[model samples]
Target: MTRIVFLDRDTLPTRPFCFDFPHDYAEYGLTAPDELAARIAGADIVICNKVVFDRAAFAAAPRLKLIALTATGYDNIDLPAAREAGVTVCNVRAYGNESVAEHALMMMLALMRNLPAYMRDVAAGVWQNAPFFCHFGAPVRELHGKTLTLFGRGNIGQTLAGYARAFGMTVLWGERKGAASVREGYTPFGQALAQADVVSLHCPLNAQTRHMIGEAELQMMKAGAVLINVGRGGLADEQAVLAALKYGQLGGAGFDVLGQEPPRNGNPLLARLPNLIVTPHNAWASAEALSRMTDMVEANVRAFVAGTPQNTV
Candidate 1:
């Protein structure tokens, strides 16, 4: 019998699919941080979503053989500790690329079209006494004919680029490290950034990408261009973006994530910048994506019970 414990079940809002593992198994609905060690003590497979698997917790899971991360990123798992403990780590990949890419487009379109702001204005009765057809407190921009530049070439980024092309916008992307291979007729990232009419980010947060777009990078962008981030929030300095927004260096900004989760008080990112559009990090939670993720989880457990492995990270 294999005891499987999934920590932090609240990370996903929708109902999870029923477990259909081939071997004997137990799946806890949700386990908190404090209850982690106790619940996982005799578990052979430990599933986690944003739950810390530090040295202490890993040490306590004496019977743990396989650790399956619910998300693509395995940063929550301590790799060295898992290696010494002989715990195999695996993660689902590319399962939510289209789901996340669509979210990026949503934010971009909402910001450009003054959707949220106009709705607020109308709700406040300001549009009732309009002098003419409309009051121009919020300006709307068109998406077609604008150049869209991306910073990452991973699954989500590539999918977003495809969406940009579908909208009749030219799409370009930057290399992860060195100069990227030049696709025929495609603009290089460096060249594209300097000239992009709109720039959207889709890269992971790492040593090479932390604050990748700071003062210098912002300066390279053409003034009055929009910038969006659906990727990890640490790629751009929040303070720098605020300053740029204040001084008119950046025309508009949209984000589905922030550097800090649940965003701390006085984080300096909450200052009401009218041109900025921010949403809680729910970009990957579409119903279709969650269904696929559940399938991946089942596959992971079945593989482990069969003395095999799948989706190794």
Candidate 2:
């Protein structure tokens, strides 16, 4: 029987796994760095979401044949090490497009309309004690007639574009930064930033894309433009973003990720700001998306066992 071990089952909600083949399955709610090697030893397959599987861990799992990822990102796993160890790695994809797009849209709408500021006023009785019939403090903006620039044209970006279009906003696909030339359907990076009323990022995090947005890029954007990031935390410089928000360089900003998970050390962007919104990286955790991701993980495992691996990364 094939042995399958899920090292960090607590990262995701409880979901049923129905593997067709005979297997010895084991799972733990959470696994720390020191406990990883021993738990995965002698396992033929390993399933995980955020657990790191470095070269040393791969060496310890001598019988590991597959690394099935429940999330779309495979950054936690060392692909080169897995390849050397003959471990086929697969990741689920396109399972959270709607969920993530909706989250991004929600952030954009809330920021544009100054929802947070109004909520605070309501809670503080500022609205109840208003001298006038209505209280209008923060400047509210509408999505219609604004230009939205998207850094990625993948599933989530495309989904967001459709939603933006429905609100009568013009959409622009931004070409990669420092490219020799712009793609057919993409605007040059700098030009996109200058023209955007709102900017959304959906690109993956890698060496080439890390810290892609910083002081220089922020300066290139319109003074009152909104920035939305549902992608990886490392994609933008959080310190620079906080500075931009503080000085009114940016009208507002929204983020669903940070450079560090849990941010145990604290992050500058966490400070209370009327124009800033930060979620605990739950953009892809909607019930529908979680179910779809679970189903995709099962498919990847079954495909790998049948000698026809799919969604390999």
Candidate 3:
């Protein structure tokens, strides 16, 4: 009999997580760092999303065989620690490609057309007194004929490139920063940044990529170009973006994630900038994506239990 424990069940909004095989399972709405050991003491498997499992937690759970992630990103878990403890880790991939690509497009379209400011004007009754057929408060740009630079070449980024191409926009895949040589299909990273009318990021955050787009990078962008980040929040310098928005250096910006989620402490980008749009990191939470994620999770667990494992990360 396998004992599986889900440390943070509230991470996913919709659930009744099912397993095809017979096993004993338990779930906790939320679990803090201090509660990890006690909650997983007797468990043979742990399932989590956005929950941190350190070396100590792994050492405490001698019977733990697997750590199943409900999301793609595994930055929250300690990989080396899991490996040292002989715990197999698995994550679902490509499940949210369509959902995330669509979200990046929505953000780009909204910012490019100045939809936020226009909507605000309409909501404030600025259009009620009708001076003419229509009213415009800011410059509206079209997607056609603009150069779009994508920072990641993964599934989500490739999907967005297809979408951009279908809209008559030219797309450039950017090579890694400071790479010794450029790849066949990728543009030199900095050169692509300079040529882009719209820049979208889908890269993972790590040592080399944290704050990859700071003040200097912002200065390199075209004066009126827009930036869209549907990836990690730490990829850009939030304060620099705010300053750019204030001084008109950046035409507009859209972000689906922040440097810190729930940003309760406060963030400069959280201000009501008409040219900026921020979503609560739900770009990958579409109904279809969630269903696929759930199905993959079940499959991964079943395969691991049957002497084979898939999607190891």
Candidate 4:
């Protein structure tokens, strides 16, 4: 028998299969930091989403053999400590790639089309009273023939590049910084930012990428260029992003993630100007994607139980 405890079940909105597994399984909807020790005392598998299994918690769970991350990003887990503790840490990859890529485009479209301002006009009865054929609150730009700069070339980045291609946009990928050598078509990060009409971020958050897009990077962007971040929130400095929008360094900016989830009420970016569109980090939570996420988790757990590991971090 195996005990599979899922901490922070609220983090994942998907419903999982209730059927019998080969090993005894137990599911806890959610677990808090304080509850980790007691909750994972005898568990064989601990599933989590955004819940930190810190060094203390790892030391507390002696029977734990696996830490199942519900999403692609595993920074929430301390991988080095897990490895040292002989605990396998794994996360699903590209399970929601297409869904998140489309969502990123949706945010970009809203910014380009000024959807929010127009929607406000309709709700305020101004549109109904308008005698003109159209009202111009913001300039709507054509995506065709525009240049799209990709910050990271992972699954999601390539997926978005494909969408840009469909829209008749030119794509340029950003190369790693501080490397003398460069990929054939990819340009240096700095040059890509300077040349792009629209820049999309799809990189993970690491020491090298933390605040990768800051005031200096924003300053290098062409006037009136749009910025999109569908990657980790820590990649961009929120204060700088808000400042850029306020001063028009960026004509428009769209984001699916923020530095903090359910961000503090006083987050600088939340109070920024009209050109920003913020969603509640739902880019990867579509129904179809949720199903795929759960299916992958089941597969990973089954494989681990069968003396194999799949979809690892």
Candidate 5:
């Protein structure tokens, strides 16, 4: 019988997993770094969400053949080590596009209309104490006729563009930064930043994209523009964003990820700014998306065990 170890069970719901073939499987609610080696001992396959699988972990589990990821982002895994060890790694994709895109739109609308500020005012009884029927302490804007610039042209970005157009907003795809010539379908990066009323990022994090939006880029953006980041947190400079918000260079911003998970080292973006909204890295955790992801993971596992792996990366 095949033995499989799920390193971090709490990454998903506590419901039972369905597999067509009979196998020996073990799951832990959470797995600490030191416990990784012992927990995955003697296992042929390992399933993980955010657990870091480094060289040491791979060395500790010589029997491991497949590493099935439950999430799209596999940066946490050491791909080079896995490849050297002849271990197959697979990831699920496009399962969270609809959920993440919808979240991006929601953040855009919330920032555009100053929803957070107004909601806080209402909660503080500022509305009830008002002498007039309506309280308009902050400026509110409409999404219609606004220009939205997207940093990526992937599935999530394309989905968000369609939603933006439905609300009468114009969409512009950003060209690669500092490219000598702009791509045919994309607008010049600097120009797009200057013209956008709302800017959304969907790009992946890598060497070129780390801190892609920093002080200089923030300064180039139009005053009072809203920025939304549904991509990796390291894509934007958190301190720069905080400065922009304080100086009114940016009207507001929304982030679903942070540079550091749990912010154990402390993050500047955690400050309670009236114009900033932060989510607990859950933009892709919607019920429908999670369900789809689970199904895809099962498919990946079954295919790999059948001698033909799919979605390998």
Candidate 6:
């Protein structure tokens, strides 16, 4: 029988797996760095999300044949080490498209309408003692007649474009930064920033994309334009964003991720600002998305065992 071990099962917060093949399955709610090697020892398949597996771990797991990922990103795993160890790696994809797109849209609408500021005022009884029938403190902007520029043209970005179009907003796909020539359907990077009333980032973080948005990019944006990031946190410089928000260089900013998750140390973007909104990286954790991700993970594992690996990364 094949031995399967899930290192960080609590990350999914979903239903238990139902494998079709005969297997010895084991799971841990959360696995620490020191506990990983022993937990995965002698296992034919290892499933994980956000667990870092280095060359040492791969070397220790002599029986490991497959590394099934619950999330779309496999950055946490060392792909080179896995390849050398003869381990087949697979990751779920497009499962969180709708969930993440909706989250980004929600943040855009809330920031543009100054929803958070008004809710705070209402909670403080400011609305009850209003000078007039209504209280209008912060500037409220509409999505209609505005330009929405997207950095990535993936499934999530396309879905967001459709939603923006429904609200009468013009959508533009931005070409990669520092490219020699612009793509057919994409606007140049700097030009897109200057013309955008709102900019959303959906591109993956890599060598050329990490810290892609810094002081220079912020200065290029239209004054009082909103910035939305549901992608990786390392895509933007947190200090630069904080300064932009403080100096009124940006109308507002929304982020679902930070450079370092759990942010146990500290982050400049964590400052209390009326124009800033930060979510705890739950943009891809909607019930529907989680269900799809778990199902895909199961399918990947089953297919690998049947000698036809699917969703290989």
| Number of clashes recorded per candidate | 0, 0, 0, 0, 0, 0
State which candidate has the highest lDDT.
Answer: 6
Clashing pairs in 6: none
Cα RMSD (angstroms) for every candidate in the order listed: 2.4, 1.2, 1.1, 1.9, 1.2, 1.0
| lDDT ranking of the models | 6, 2, 5, 3, 4, 1
TM-score of 1: 0.91
Q: Which residue pairs show collisions in model 3? A: none
lDDT accuracy of residue 167 in candidate 1: 90
Collision pairs in model 2: none
> In TM-score terms, which candidate is top?
6
lDDT of model 1, residue 250: 87
Instruction: Write the residue-wise lDDT of candidate 4 on 210-275 in tens digits.
Output: 898899999999988888888888889999988988888888888888898789765777873678
Compared with the true structure, what per-residue lDDT tens digits does model 1 show for residues 48-100?
78888889988898889998888999998899999999999999888899999
What is the TM-score (0 to 1) of candidate 3? 0.97
lDDT of 5: 0.93
Worst 10 residues of 2 by lDDT: 7-16
Q: Write the per-residue lDDT of candidate 5 for residues 1-313, one digit (tens) a residue.
A: 9899998888887356778887998999899998999998899999999999999988999999999999888988999999999999999999989999999999999999999999999999999999999998779999999999999999999999999999999999998787799989899989999999999999999888899899999999999999999999899999999999999999999999999898888899888888999998899989999899889989999999899999999
lDDT of each: 0.81, 0.94, 0.92, 0.84, 0.93, 0.94
The local distance difference test score of model 6 is 0.94
Candidate 2 local Cα displacement, residue 10, angstroms: 0.4
Deviation (Å) of 220 in candidate 4: 1.7
TM-score of each: 0.91, 0.97, 0.97, 0.93, 0.97, 0.98
Which runs of model 4 end up more than 4 angstroms from their true locations? Answer: 18-20
Residue 292, model 4, lDDT: 91
